[model samples]
Target: MAKRRREHLFIETDGQVYLVRDRGTLRFPRKGEELAFPTRAGGTMDFGDDVVRRLKPVLDHHPEEWYQRDALFDRDDVDGLVKRAIYNTMIRCVSEVVVSKGNRVLMVKATRGFSKGHWNLPGGFMDYGEGPEEGVLREAEEETGVRVVLDGPLNVYVSGFPGKPAYSLGFLFRGHATSEEFRPKADEIERVDWFTVDKALTLTRNPFAKWGLVDFFLQSPEARRALRVRRHGLWDGATRAVRPTVFLDRDGVINRGRKGYVRTPDAFEFLPGAIEGMRILQDAGWRLVLVTNQDMMGWKLVPDRQLHRIHEAMLATLRKEGVRLAEIYYCPHHVLSDCACRKPRPGMMLAAARDLGVDPRQAWMVGDKVLDLEFGRAFGCRVAWVGPKEWRDRFAKEAAEWHPDVVADGLLEAARAIAGRPEGPARGRGAGRGAGRARRRGTARS
Candidate 1:
């Protein structure tokens, strides 16, 4: 209840009076309870005759989404209707991420050739069989030459530009200047200079991004703190150093595997985003590593040479896409075989982490199985589970036999969740559970 109380902010929603507060439900009935209006969307609520001049900017920031369901603003701007998604939505898209010393963030310039005319957190269109996370890293590096350390999510924003009719999501993450060495692609950036928050706001045209259109964004003195740029640097050995590691998983996380080990290249199926993901990591200067387990091979069900062939095929596929892989790791052992390389055991994860020269905890372990999380947890890596919640229910319960972490419907959702995407395109409803989950993790035995 303390997150918000009652406040009197007149809003124009079907005559519904909303007590717009700092960060909670904004719309309220005249004599009833206040309903959630939306935040980062705090712009339009203040657009009244009494304070027209005082809250014009806020009104302008009401966002185009509002018009999708409700009313419209009195005065219009070409940028109107095309606005940033709610701040919470932004968080959902790239909700949050980790930061380490010396990471590079792309400051893409708006060009006649590109989509916009201002700098956006660096990223490009999703590639065939590639997730957004990898695309962003690849785009950043292909545009800017610095190697990067992709830590975690930050925020997701939606905005519109002149002549553009659709909404584009912004996936921002915490990053740093990795090498202090950067060169922009031709016209990719008019001028590239590291600018802090204050400097960013000082930009000629604020790109009409989520922050520019809303009042709540820069309203609070504390809110404008960093100009919304990501954080950089972590102390180590009394000095700061660059840390870039592309975190990936084996099985569906990387090459291709489903329900069992894909020992032979013939069984390999690069699940959509595999190659592009690796490519993005490589261009971004992040050390690419595959943390995986090949248990079936131990049972004589899969072939080692086939595993190698699959990896070779994966690399070849990446090459065709103008992308490349950094490194590959896998555990060719079984759970009952008493070997430490199997998933749910940190042996493989630890080995991969050590090989990559990164703290297992700081690295990302993106996978489709419960043991994926187990290995990540065991080796001290941040875990990202990609799969339908229902598909994962039995597994989550099984994973209870080990630990808990983030879950999604494959690497794409994992990417959006990691990048902090607001809302995914509507999909089929989940059955049984109110949240539509078929099974939920309760507890498990080892």
Candidate 2:
């Protein structure tokens, strides 16, 4: 049998190793040759003691003529190979802290590194000898200038991307800041501020940090409660407070309702006048929010990431037309499950009220289904049932039973009626007398 090829490096008298390419062969550098190695950043740096130590094991087993360090450090694949080597040899540990004050989480905007300009938790790679908890505290202080007193470990997450050579074992901790004051390291962090749990979730783009935040919100009752309260910032006192929000149902009300599910972005198509109706409501000083039932997630009919992509496409389209939603809340439970967030349960509405600081009693809920009307009524919202007259007639018993304030053919008519504009002609019952009767009877009854 042929002997296995051995890869090694030549060591000098002073314990430094110099590699050079000569005549298409890799060999030890001549006495007066430059001492440096190509860096992944397209520059050269000293081939220091660290590299020497890493290569020592290979040196111990291989013969002098078997030097193959240059093969491992080939210019074309050096970065990936080095990363793979490190990843295979040892575990890369990272630590992050979720620091909270009241119902707000502290977040930092990265000024450098891969997450530049993105909001992230105050954390980083753990030091060589530091414990995960100690490393997290140190990182928190370094990034936000606040010493965090840890409550406990929130979770341990293993994260990596497919086809990527690097991965990390991340430790997340729940903690509280010593003070509100922050002096962010200017070189690494651009800004340090507190955000409500919902806002923080939207702002943080790093998956690891987002997962940690999600875990913190799920595990901490205090954090969950904070999500409902209005977040008041330093400048909020001088500004007009929260606006009345209009809770919209997603499928039939905004986009064309699908049979099974929307499932993908390509399958999502907006109904005519939907964007115009939303824009009208937004311009009329109403905060637009979406409350939807996405039970396909619970049933495993669609993955969470696919749903996210669909929403992203929808939001991007709305942005193109100058409309924006304040927040989106969806119930991801199966219809058979008794979950609080499902339609007709009032959970999503209550959470929306808390997060957006709007009273549901003064808000409007426009949707096409009986459950949507019931959901709005459950939360004391003025409900508008949007559908053709035939559809309303088919569910006439439910219509009279729920007593929706406005019955419109589509979202545009509903918006007009809600905004106190003439809705052309009465569709089923106008908001004038119907709303008066509905309000007098109280939405809570039947």
Candidate 3:
């Protein structure tokens, strides 16, 4: 009988997925060769050639260390992108419990592990062939020397280390320790202590611990209800939840974006064919969401009440046209503010996904500026740009990294391109996924 190959974990970020073979070693699959990574179900998936091509430039600088242990996973940040793809090859499945005594929760200082020396909840890697319930009970006793009877799961947190090809899907449960005393394992834990929620806030270094504490203590009843819906398999994973939505930028794509802000209802003018274009998208079964940058409002150039009225009018106009927008979210900060929700930051898109049960990777973003295109790309969405000929031509030349999937003269043209296709992101307009001219904007009237 042959021994089965041990599974390893692979990580894909910003479209670059790489594999590390040994737990503590660094290894890269061959270039221009068909390769497979083990999946969680004991199957293998083809790691495509495109992944190899993107990795070559980095390999040239450290050819000898390509297969060295911890070569790629030890960095602070793998360039600018985080781990968006976490393959099950080397994933760790663990379970932790929040066993609180009075106002204090149980915490242990880890003597070793990925988060060694950091204060973490009582948990460890789930041994193969054991259920999560069995694993959590066993881990609690093994680490803290206190047997626990778990009640119900508080929440599940999926977290990954920066620049490491590993991730943990952890189940946090609320339980009570059988004994109030504890003896820390000499190898795995330094000490077990009870800390108040406020004190735990300062000591807990693990992201999952912090998240679990918030879910247990700080989350409102309404938020808890929302969390239940999210936890019930409406999402695929922690990173990308699959919801079909059309993320639209307000000023340019919906209305005629001008030099100054659209401050009043009178100034909120829809561009020609904008209403009909929205109707076409709605008919095609795409959820409409408005993601706009209203930096003028944050700067006090426009009052919040007036801005609310403007959005109300926009929504009312769409409803009159039989188009229902799922939601409207705007970033009210200056371009220089560097707020997370600003255009190009992807903060609002992520928040929308969490709030609306939408999947960004499977959605579309239609906008008119370079920032908008970048924002779509950041969230793994298909992008369509609506702009004048001169502006489109300039983007194609200078900002290819932010190249849009489709280019149109206005909202109507962009909508036609979107509706003309089946359900999918618009491929490059006659560009063949490389540098080429966008298809000339159609002249069809709305």
Candidate 4:
């Protein structure tokens, strides 16, 4: 009879049973070497010479179990084993770190494995009994020889290959390097270098790594300042006690409107020319602030953290295009809740005025819906209606009543017209005493 394949060897030591897997064959750890025994929960425990000493006694007690002949497999048993093997799945934990110094970020070129010859963040598969944070720190040191001091977690990314049952869950972290010098691991890393955020984004080949860089760009103060310099040059140090501001609506105006809601980052997509329009406004020295109604939160359709993740990705994309928002405010009340901050109420605008120290009268409110127009009118700001002609025709009576100062094809056209006007408040339908009275009445009611 052919010998049965011995997949694992059992070792008993100190009243404990340990398993040593050797890929369908039994092998003992050599002197000064340690063997890893994987636990039932997918973690591993290491055992060395102490366990090795008891191997002989365990083999002596279970000689038949260890050296048993290959059992004849019936068709039903073989089929069950094949089915289980085919359907079994496993999730691997991976951790990566984005190490930064001033305006530069650290990245490594890989010499081996799947990402060979491409640049990637310094990280690897997590080890036994290590959490993501601890694993990332170890990986950073192992690959780049840099001790990273973690600032915080950035995001989690999941990846799986087609036709594969295993998936990898990656934990990304942001950190600052403790030392400038790098000693790249010779076996896995080709070299390490620091790069500007823009350059690093171009060099990174892994999608998950790129997402981490995007999050870093959004959260890093130094990176944001560097981006500002690249976009607008050095701030001339001119002080403006009251800068002109633009209050924007989020869903329909900034991103494509969704039927249900933008519950995930994957569902959020920028409308055509939206980023360019925002860039134009920013370049013209306008402080962009987002004011939106997010009733999804009130309805328990989306969690606050999930919504924040969506915005993080949104802001990161905008920053990539050289546009930065001064602030974002959203009403987390149900549509039927009569919340003061909801559109058509002046609560959000009032808060914006006090927080940003900008006059609502001098600001321009741009949105696609009629509630947005009414909100701007109530706040005593010039309003621009953004949509196609069909939409305008559909809401002709509301448009006529609201009398938006500008009705354009979209935000790009509206922004161009608004930016061309002279510095001071443009002569529009909604400004001065009547609008102020309207604002006062709205504030009083709220």
Candidate 5:
């Protein structure tokens, strides 16, 4: 019988050994086979020991089945395998999607694994060689026996196992399921049910569910329409470019603004009626987009991972209130930077217009500051200012200089004006080309 090939690396300090070999089990070393390079003890394995140096050359010539216990480092062999080694360690792919229909979303109750009895979105890891859209569709079908069509990406979560070398890149998609009734897989899921936005929040323990459903889709009316627009096939992913858009500011408009930076999710609280305003705009054929300046990232006040968490929390909170943002665009540059995407610069707006296939000239920008108005003007968009009396007074001084096309007390009023609601004072307000400043002068006084 042939002996199984194995590789070994010895550590003398604590009398521990490391081994790597091919096995059917994909987990780390078994009880008898511990191969982790780093151990609990602060012991460093030195390959330059005299005994290892003597056996180095012989070990290099042999197949890579096992490292000689006393082998020294071999530069050429190690160099050749670096690319292959690194490739083996990196794992990036979409895992699943949360499918929504109006205020309700499909959630499967877990029957096995560590999530036993807990509810989560219907999805699993994408198959090898499959695109994200395809994988999500397949997983949705396999897990819940329901067909769903992809709308677009909601968010990309970058995560990893505590001790694993590979990373998990999860793409959360917003989709509409074709069938409401589904039979859960006997092993993976106990049952499937449609949970309302509020119910899902109370029942779901999964963070992604909180991030994707509770914070995003439930609040977005346009997204809800996209999920159910099968009658006309408008959401067949082809004719989305012509949709109208409403660009929103992050601070002051969607959430409370402060003199200091909102550096964490704890500091991020929604302004009253912010979600309702977005929902109103979305129902009126306007896709809600968040275009914000997060200079905190560039100034190193917050890291990207931390910001990612904050955005996730924000989305989760908004979703809880039944608001769905079409997309979010953030410029991480500091004020000192000349980057185009920063507020008062049209870079982010232009990028969003191109990416979302929306007409920038027809879009409306809602913000509380002069920079927001400047950004809208630069993008050829009509602007709405939602500010307190002090800020409005300040903006009034600039009415003759350059002002927003409309001024509203808050985001809900601004949304009402954009939606042409009868209750809105700005309904029937029109800002002709080169006449926006003049219109603002009259509106500012009123």
Candidate 6:
């Protein structure tokens, strides 16, 4: 007769029911966690909220039933979507915006300014589980060097902006701060001060203002509460959790390697079918990242500028070949360097994911070397290896190291494997999870 813990909550937006599982902790099949068939199905899933309701009935039949949600429950697709919506609703996404006021409010600092001198309230990306009030307050204090208290309602706009496929969906708040406690976080703020609302409007070189901040704030109530976060279930809340963007590792997967270090631009080289493979994945809508380890800089084997030039050549070649990359993140440190940006460490890729708003779990990593594969797997990506079979056999000794979801010859074949298409014969390399390095490049520039 114990009460079932409630791990899920309901959020309703636009009259649609969305399920959110506040619990993200019922840890089991995390990214990179070994895949295993269920021996017994009974276990707790950390879905948010206080009560753990009976597992959704449909889930017993279809484990992936957590994906469909959002539609009139009366519709044919209603049930599954409802369940996913509910499951997703158990989680939440929150961001921040700051409203700095002096004797009178003037200009608001822009978080990411569009036009030159166009300013708005300063705020930043929120970490997981941080509340909106806490987020805004923290940002206000960090940006203005002032500690403020949230005094009102959360204003949200579900609208789109230019260059965006969807909307610049965001939330905002009004707050009060003391001049004594106000000091901007250095390097983030150019200057923090007060100006007349009219002076701000006129002095700013940029003309685009959704309307002056004062005029906008005047229209909304600071103290009045608005509609709370609406809840949806598995079927209704599904859209919020889109298939994630991927972060890829470069070097081994993109081109033949340079022994010792591909120190100069001339040393940079691409493997066969590499560019085409990248284009295929890009066209299929996957964000490609280049996570590389270049310890030569610490060893003075390569200068930072030389490395940049090499990357420039690499990118130009890709651009000419019609390959578009979301970004290329490199780690210039050695394992002993202890710098947070190196691989086998996950700092660089992790940082890139944070900046690009990508989910590591939804990401994929491919490489030829053991450390690269190990690093990617540890960082939450589904991993793949390219190269030889004996290499995998050698890898078996460290089988506890990393796991590859699939193995193929080179980049082209690997891309096919990710798309769920069986790979053709790997011309220069062998296949399987514990395979050899595909298109291995020497550490020396020949």
Displacement of the residue 331 alpha carbon in candidate 4, Å:
0.4
Q: What tens-digit string does per-residue lDDT give for candidate 6 at 250-307?
A: 6666766766767788877888888887777666556566777777876878877777
lDDT of 1 by residue, 152-255 (tens): 54444454332222244445455444775777666665545543322232232322222321222222233333222110111121321113344577666655
Question: Which of the two, 1 or 3, has more TM-score?
Answer: 3
Question: Could you tell me the TM-score of candidate 4?
Answer: 0.42
Query: Mind giving the per-residue lDDT tens digits that candidate 2 earns over 343-395?
Result: 77666765654444544434789999998987776565578999878988899
Error of 2 at 48 (Å): 99
For model 5, state the Cα shift of residue 33 in Å: 99
Stretch of 10 with least lDDT, candidate 6:
223-232
RMSD list, candidates in order: 20.6, 22.6, 15.8, 23.0, 21.7, 18.9
Kindly list the per-residue Cα lDDT of model 5 for residues 131-239, writing each as its tens digit.
8788888778877986788877776655554333456666788778887678667788888887654345445654445445523443366433333200111122432
TM-score-wise, the better of 3 and 4 is: 3
Name the regions of candidate 4 deviating beyond 4 angstroms: 1-241, 423-446
Which residue pairs clash within candidate 3?
8-89, 8-90, 9-89, 9-90, 25-69, 26-68, 26-69, 241-359, 243-359
Candidate 3 ranges with C-alpha deviation above 4 Å: 1-243, 424-446
TM-score for each candidate, following the candidate numbering: 0.39, 0.43, 0.45, 0.42, 0.41, 0.42
lDDT of 4 at 292: 85
Candidate achieving higher TM-score, 2 or 3: 3
* lDDT measured at residue 349 in model 6 versus the true structure, 0 to 100: 49
lDDT of 4 by residue, 1-446 (tens): 85433222234333333332345533333334454432221212223212212232323243333221122122232222222322233366888888888878899999998789988888878886799998988888988886789998887776665333346777888888888788888899998999866566556656557556655665677765554211111122332234578889998888998989999999999989888888777777677888888889889999878878888889889888889887777887788965557777655665555444445435889999998988776665678999888988899788777788888888899889888876434334222323322222111000
Say what the RMSD of model 5 is.
21.7
All candidates' lDDT scores? 0.45, 0.67, 0.64, 0.66, 0.60, 0.50
Q: lDDT score, residue 162, model 4? A: 36
Best by TM-score: 3
User: Candidate 2 — worst ten consecutive residues by lDDT sum?
Assistant: 437-446
Residue 317, candidate 5: alpha-carbon lDDT = 83
Write down the lDDT that model 3 would get.
Answer: 0.64
